[model samples]
Target: MGRKVEEVVEVLVEPIANRNGLELVDIEYSKEGQDWILRVFIDKKEGVSLDDCQSVSRELSDILDKKDPIDKTYLLEVSSPGIDRPLKKDEDFIRFSGRKVDISTYAPINGEKKLNGELLGIDEGNIKLVVDGEELNIPREKVSQARLAVEF
Candidate 1:
């Protein structure tokens, strides 16, 4: 049910984002307490602003209201992915190379399941990382999740 809502929202909002010179980073639909929240993450080369979020929210809200995609009432939130934005696509790896990232694999890599380091990008279907001053190659398929890591 939730997945369908996400899919519908994605299909509806992606064109709107592109038309506005924005990238639709992700969509999430979930229930928290008694509320269903639909979150849309957007991005641009120059980053997103409050006005950008409001614009997207307004435009998408109109479309959603017209299409009536979801049967349940949900709160719609549009925002930037922030500094710790997720790295989900191959292009994301290339675009964000040299940034710090947290990666987790389905199974142990070099006896470790989690690694935090600089993103070295993709190489021959492997994710390259520089952890603790040592380079490591992790197969892309082995990665279960990955996101930018804040180093402070």
Candidate 2:
């Protein structure tokens, strides 16, 4: 059910995104507390605009009504991924090259699950980071979740 909904949303959203020159960051359909929420996170090479969200929301709403994919009620939200955007794909690493990031793993990498360093981006299938003068190569598969790190 989850995958089916994601696929439908992906199909419905791509054309709208392409037409508007926006990048579809992710499609999420999940239970939030007691309510089901459908969240679409979008981006652009430069950034996303309010008008961009409006355009996508308007187009997607029409498709959802026509398809009636979900039987139960769900809140639909279309928005930008924001400053701490998720690092979801290898392309994201490439795009965000030289940005600082925070990543955790399923198991420790060099006895650490948490790493905060400059994102040198992906080299082959590994992510390169410099931590305390030591260069570390973490296999992509080991990453649990990663995002842009906030600097103070």
CA RMSD for every model? 1.5, 1.5
Q: How close is candidate 1 to the true structure, as a TM-score?
A: 0.91
Whole-model lDDT per candidate:
0.93, 0.90
Runs of candidate 2 exceeding 4 Å displacement: none
Per-candidate count of clashing residue pairs (backbone under 3 Å): 0, 0
Query: After superposing candidate 1, which stretches have Cα over 4 Å from the reference?
Result: none
TM-score of each: 0.91, 0.91
Model 1, span 8-73: residue lDDT tens: 899999999998999998898999999999999999999899999999999999999999989999
lDDT of 1 at 143: 97
- What shift in Å separates residue 27 of candidate 2 from its native position after superposition? 1.8
**Candidate 1, poorest ten consecutive residues by summed lDDT:** 82-91
Number of colliding residue pairs in model 2:
0
* lDDT of model 2, residue 6: 85
